[model samples]
Target: MIRRVLACSVALVAVCSLGGCGTLPGFGDDTTEVTVWLMRNSASDDFVQRFKHGFEQEHKDVELDVRIQEWTGIGEKIDQALKDGDAPDVIEVGNTQVPRYAASGGLLDMTLESLRDWGSDAWLPGLAQPGNVDGMQYGIPWYAANRVVIYNKDLFAAAGITKPPKDRAEWLADTAKLNSGQNQGIYLAGQDWYTLAGFVWDEGGELAQEGTGDWKGALDSPAALRGMAFYKQLQALGNGPRNADEETPPQAGIFAGGKVAQMIAVPGAAKAIQKANPRLADKLGYFPIPGPTEAKPGAVFTGGSDLIIPRRTAHRAAAVRVVAALTGEKWQTDLAATMNYVPNKSTLAHAVEGQAGTAAMARGAAQGRATPNSPQWAAVEADNPIKPYMTSVLNGADPKRAAKAASDRITTLLFP
Candidate 1:
């Protein structure tokens, strides 16, 4: 049996900071021990144990030892572990973080056929692309989600709008109807990079374009500036807190008051709305933000996790098997339902297709995209020039000029 290791938050951080302390969850007497590290909350203990036991059943001599890690300082911690020759057999990496490891050759390079054997064409849209660096598979997607929009049903009824907006004009028109001056409509976070990217992608814009040798910032492109202009246009329709960005996800708090007609939402938002204002919780409805074409959902920046084998693991074959089993069809189906994530394997997302909320999730997942390919993306995100540049455009600076400045900064980050 695998043991559970629990530590206080402070202790956990300290232990991780000085490189990992291995054998936390368990060290079975079995000769073959396969250790796995999972990001906290990425998967529930119950399901993980199931996979652990399943792997053991398949390989009688091997024992699976599971350890939990926090997102904070994880990259540095993992790197420390590798430096100290204490890396785990398999590690779960955030999708966006895959490039850093893959480009640095910190992960094993599995052949394309080997990856297909694990989860092939049935994989969710854009989930597998991040793992394919230079056309070699270094990681496999585990799960995914599309950030979406949630609106007040009561406000929709009051406006005589029977359905959610199907296109940009309809979206703006509905917001106009909901804005009675005492409260705002269409609560958009000014500095939120994900939603900002969504608007850009909705109009066929890109945050950065991946080049042969390095990534180039595309914010100055006509399509991207048009999207930025559209984002500015939305700010004009509704008023909320200014200077907000990913520093805090401020839209949920603003829209939970029930007076706001609509706002962008994410997973766990329903529970948050209930906590913020229980009465209006039941009135909330969800939909994918529609694209320029009414028939398709707007482009969402799909976020997800990936499973990879560290280059140093001795039991490469065993670790690969565990990754394959964990991402198998049966496990994928149950996990998607439990976590309310669009399954990394989209064919398995059927678990939630019957409901209005999850159906919208399914639709959005179809139109979703991962971030552009750039190992140095961490630098861009760290510098975070895009949000402030967006704020400048919203604050009346010329959109093209603002975009050019942001693009220049992004180019430096992506190259430097």
Candidate 2:
């Protein structure tokens, strides 16, 4: 296991200091080289170059070597690097991956630094809470992206819907009006659990609850069942596959076919729709998923990246500085503007004021929530029972029994 390899390097963490470490081959003795591994497409090359120039101007003694890595098989790559004691000083990982790495004791504890310099209190709860594993902050939130209702403007107009829904009731009403012969109101797949997670959270239900030392699935709870009931009611409005997810045949391609009126996706999906069928380039619009009431937007799963410093990095201080710069207000604002991402902190929403899609995403992210903060959560996802449970419910199975069965599987995986 990766933990075994990471555990062996715990002793080197204390001695890995910037000034005390040996220099890299290309850098002079006076320079501290900080290597960063960012996921592909997270930032544009131009934006990275701009950051490098600006950061290097401020810290002349440090050289930033930023490398973009592909997402496929990244977990194993990261594990291997940690095992070899050759991990990058800073790495960008999914927010959900924090617990697994932090639990392995291969991450630098940044609780003090987060509180002292990064203003930990104001960060978005969805992005912030997952990083705070066992009361210690390991992942520093970089940027966030969540699902929104990407709709066809022409379809809404044709249906006489003057505006987007302000609440779940209105959304259902609007979708029903838009769903007619040969047209789908919304292409919401039955097993799209990330979207389902929002409804569960809206009803104040958790997918899994943390107990004394383990997690127990809570999908069988009354509130969660109510959320599932609502999902069933909405899924019947359109012709989404009950046994598949948004990506089975690529929902973006389906939406681009011009018969679907709406879909729940990140704003980035609009680009794909446009790419598939260029006619939708100017016909699309975005809005946050409406909540049960108009008081707030629906809760969404905040999917985004976080920056981490490996425990065995030679340039620990330089890595910390690099993380600070990336998560700082200046770069955060630039990143949001350039990439249309929600800033790490809710206070930075103003950065994307004029961008409609990102603005809607930011609003939903205000009430966003992450998955269960357990090291075994990743394993649960790998062999996910929730998808089949959703399908079973949609296919006429008893909700309570299906939920109970899925919950049992979850408990076993979470505590395995």
Candidate 3:
């Protein structure tokens, strides 16, 4: 009986050892899982699904949990998660929101060594700017998108314009010519903040400037005033959308129907327009936003989502691996082709060449600039007073007076 019992004990021990029943948990343990939080954007959803499936398939022992959060309530959700100690291991955050989250210690400082180890340095400088706060890296560039002047070639020809405008004056003249009965010359989406920012940067002015350990408002400068005045002049030219609220559908519908001449738009709209009217795909033309001065064409704002590691994650290594996979060349190449975004890496630009409207956007990304990296930037921008002030300026409000009021309001917000 003693000998039989010893043999049974030995067999049990072997079984347990092979099954990992008595080992201290280490990296890649069977029970280890990574949770990723992301925005519910069209691009992110596609990337996450593919990435999760591929990574989990390759690593059978590991599991991935994805949580999609609405963008409107993401900030509050992140804050709540962090407070409750239930934050995701990896997160997809807006490029502009990086500074705010980093400042609040909501994100982990991903070192340069990690980027080098993952071979992510090949991405363009502008794409990586969002992840760098105060010279420290905390996020990775997943993908990027930029605004460009999309025009209907048919409308241009009808207006007797042989070529797209190469400078601001030409754009103005062209818009005036396109402004005919019920067929507006241009479609300026005044209520869209992103579009307004493009115009602001084109005039060689910025919303904020680097100050002593923070950012100060600069929207009231002469250059910005001039830019606003130009937008107002254009708004007066025809029956364009009154604000950005009504601008997108009407402009897109009109352009696809061959009524409007040109407008500023993102790359995603290209595919939508093509789907709406297949013939317009071939008729569409893209150009960089023209600057006020001949020497410096206007710059468009860089807006896109980025990958981050929340500080509260339990599976750091797994989360890092997930981020690496999502931002890797293979995934980025595929994403750029499907989503019409500029690949984060310049080398990946070639993957999206044959796609409509992407080549011009890639060119624009190579030459675009980012908004000021400040935690308070969103607040200052969202102030109700500023938009109306801009609307007033766009409606032929005095440049100096409108600028003064905007400057004063921004100054109070920043300084206070």
Winning candidate number (lDDT): 2
Off by over 4 Å in 3: 1-31, 44-47, 57-61, 118-126, 241-250, 254-257, 270-283, 292-297
Candidate 3 lDDT over 181-273, as tens digits, reads 767787766655565666777777877777777566676887777667677776666565554433555557656776767777886676767
Candidate ranking under lDDT, highest first, comes to 2, 1, 3
The TM-score, computed over Cα atoms with residue i paired to residue i, of candidate 1 is 0.88
TM-score of each: 0.88, 0.92, 0.83
Total backbone clashes of model 2? 0
Task: Tell me the number of clashing residue pairs for each predicted model.
Answer: 0, 0, 5
Distance from true location, Cα of 30 in model 2, Å:
1.2
Off by over 4 Å in 2: 1-29
lDDT scores of the candidates, listed in order: 0.79, 0.93, 0.73
Worst 10-residue lDDT window, candidate 1: 21-30
**lDDT by residue (tens digit), candidate 2, 234-284:** 999899999999999799999999999999999999999999999989999
The whole-model C-alpha lDDT of candidate 1 against the native structure comes to: 0.79
The model with the greater TM-score, 2 or 3, is 2
Candidate 1, after superposition: displacement of residue 296 in Å?
1.4
List of clashing residue pairs for candidate 1: none
